[model samples]
Target: MSEQTAPRTAAGDSTDRPVDRTGGGTGRGSGGTGRGSGGGDVGGPGTVGPEPSTARGEQTRQLILETALRLFRERGYAQTTMRAIAREAGVAVGNAYYYFESKEHLIQGFYRRTHADHVVAAAPALAAETDFAARLRAVLHAGIDVLTPSHAFAATFFKTAAEPTSPLSPFSAQSSEARTEAIRLFEEVLAGSTAKVDPQLRPDLPELLWLGYLGVILYWVHDRSPDQSKTRLLIDGAVPLVDRLVGLSRLRVLRPVTTQVLELIRSLRH
Candidate 1:
């Protein structure tokens, strides 16, 4: 599947919000870069000692992460530098470095936590439902729920990623294998589904659905509705309907259109 074909819920990363992909320097949330200043170690080397200091270290790290998150949102990703983050965080540049290697490294925290949250939110609905259609709907809704909170950041990030040269682009060489692994995990979710797609297409379907999912996310990113109202509508209506359509792909009449769409997507990827 292409990026646009990925099986994504209405809630997604940067793709979910609306922002300018082109480098206008003024987008949604944040998209800036800078360097760190004030050198000091806030969370020094971890010693296998008492729990109190560990808790303190944890709190400090959280503070930095939270502070950085805010700054990144307020400023652009490119403008938010390590130095700026450290200054705002009330810590030394070395202290921020102790926790994260660079601003990009800090961004990874957003992706990592987002995926973890996706599973947590989806689990409950998935567990309660037995029908494949219902389960799929729950999974999609869960993803959307996790994503809504970061809509602003999500839009900016996706916009940045659309650029082929951006380091943060999903397909960029700079994207760590670990991040790709996250996409792989989402693929696993699709594997667990009971959607009656072609057996031959199963392996590729997850990737394709992921791409499709991303396409909707691209739309969601630019959505400006109150509470991203349009995204909610997509979740409530389009998703389940697509799920049903996929379930019905085995029908002879629809097969031609499906094949054409899939082929079109494949062409774009190449």
Candidate 2:
């Protein structure tokens, strides 16, 4: 069986840290002017137009994230400490704590930020296509695109994620929000698709699709092929089989199998 692959490039904007997409300018610069430590709120004592404090906070948060990612890439996740990241970001250790409660929180922040970028990247593809298989392929490719830029550091961090007891593990409740968001994106993929799935399979398909993505990611992490081309091949190959299986879900002959599969899935959820 040939392996699946995805679009290999950076997952989000090429920048190490993505900006606040809500249009609030989270400037990329590390030098946040603590100047105007005065203005705040919708209309507080010192300000008129939106205060610089929000921008400062955004910049500081991004700065810390950028610094921490750099350290993770350069020093490895296990070796990088929040204190080290704070020093590198030029923020007080306490300030880093204010922004992120722990190293795990920083990683959670990383997941949130990266997933947001993935949502952005996948949108155009989803909007442009309606075929379930095509939409799914595009979304999966978009996901890999978001992660590709950080390919260098992913495996190193996977060590932490692999620890079942670690909060960073994708299955951990701590990562539930990120996991849910990713699954919901897959639901969008299903909702927009023209293909018909067995209603029995419909509700759980998004999660199954996300699980497929996780499998792709796991493969990509270990993939050493030239440019991870094998991973791409895997995606290309898997899509057809997935499409076929989905198409078959509504067939009368497959009802029994689908019932058993759904039951097994439900069991695992508990």
Candidate 3:
């Protein structure tokens, strides 16, 4: 099978770090920024006015994230310490802590940024078409478009994500808000369509769909398909199933089950 390949390039933007299969902290000048858009197709912060920072707090935050992502990618996640990231970023450890409550919090930024980029990438495709299935497919494909580029090192990244101590766990305490926000975006995609379903029930559907999507991402991450071909097949096959499931959500019999499932999800959070 032909391997799946994603666009690979330096993540240039606010953060500064290097891109490599092995993770390690690079010396100051050698550190390149993570793919400003690389990472995951999670979601983004809702529309809000820019903060009233007279100075550049956002800029500093970006720098720290970029720096950390580079090192995390170059130096395996565990090997890249907060102190090392601080030193390499030319910021004091305290300063880094001020922006990120913990090292885990810093890693959450990568997921958040990647999710935001996914929204950006999918927008054009979604906007160009009105079919619900097409939009859904575009959204799923957007995830692949963003993730495949980094497949070479993606497995290592996922390995770090699996360790409970590591900060990258999508289910980690640090990632809840970001994860919820990403889930909401997927919900928005569902809501945007003309799919007939109870208005109240539809709101929570995104979280379920996101859970399904994350499963695909997990598969893709560990996928060794020459170029991650298995990952691509998964994307193509799973997304439509999700769409069909979404359509079935309108059935009366599924309503009670859906409610119970959502409650179960909420319970998991607590």
Candidate 4:
């Protein structure tokens, strides 16, 4: 819930990889203030004829998205141009624009797709585990597994995205839908778990877990250890601490501490 909880030095648009989206610029994966560049009609208004078939349109859209991402990864989000994306994808510039409003939108698309894939990856593990900690671990580990493929690009876009105020930041409103979807998955993890947590914490656990996840990600972004081995240790070690902390919530001796913590959490929203 709070990007502030993570080290500011590690930031990027995580398309399953580390990246800086300071701008989510031309090649176009985006954060918040980064709006897909709005433009005029794809072709000069009256110059259109038959549209590409539905299937063809989809393929073209995929090509443009792939090309844009490649360019973003290759040239840095700020340096990649929409025109270059068009040329690389072998589509008209107007056609590319038609599929995507701007570079930022493409970035959002990348995130949305990545999140969708993440959901798929975590499903099996979550379904098989009913224990809160186990499910939580599965979900968290699944995130890293899905991201492993993109490790090489992780740091590239993180620099741009780490900006607190940047729309390209995952915390930005532009990413609300994707962000919420991720939170919801954690919610499911809690729902299926047998962990007897404080009633209020149960509802809020997903968001808290997500915050913890962001912290892990922050570490992961900077983790250069072989196979990012350090991050795996972090997850394995941290989950038990989290599990124990949740277990502590039901103890009467900790009631005052829990109440104060809950109060602090509540105060933040106001």
Give me the candidate number with maximum TM-score: 2
Give the alpha carbon lDDT tens digit for every residue of 245-268 in model 4.
999999988979888888888798
Q: What is the lDDT of residue 113 in candidate 1?
A: 71
**Candidate 3 on 120-150: residue-level lDDT in tens?**
9988876677666677778887887887766
Model 2 bad stretches (over 4 Å): 1-53
Q: What is the Å distance of residue 183 in model 1 from its true position?
A: 3.7
What's model 2's lDDT at 238?
98
lDDT of 2 by residue, 149-213 (tens): 78899998787788878788999999999999999999999999898899999998999999999
The TM-score measured for candidate 3 stands at 0.68
lDDT of 1 by residue, 61-157 (tens): 6777788788767876655666677678776554555555555556666666777887788777666655555665576667677888778777666
Q: Of the candidates shown, which would achieve the greatest lDDT relative to the real structure? A: 2
For candidate 2, the per-residue lDDT at 30 reads 26
Provide the TM-score for each candidate, comma-separated. 0.68, 0.80, 0.68, 0.78
Q: Which candidate do you rate higher for TM-score, 3 or 4?
A: 4
* Off by more than 4 A, model 1: 1-40, 43-60, 176-185, 252-270
- By summed lDDT, the worst window of 10 consecutive residues in model 4 runs over 1-10
Q: What lDDT score is found at residue 133 in candidate 1?
A: 57
Steric clashes per prediction: 43, 13, 20, 27
Q: What lDDT, from 0 to 1, does candidate 4 have?
A: 0.70
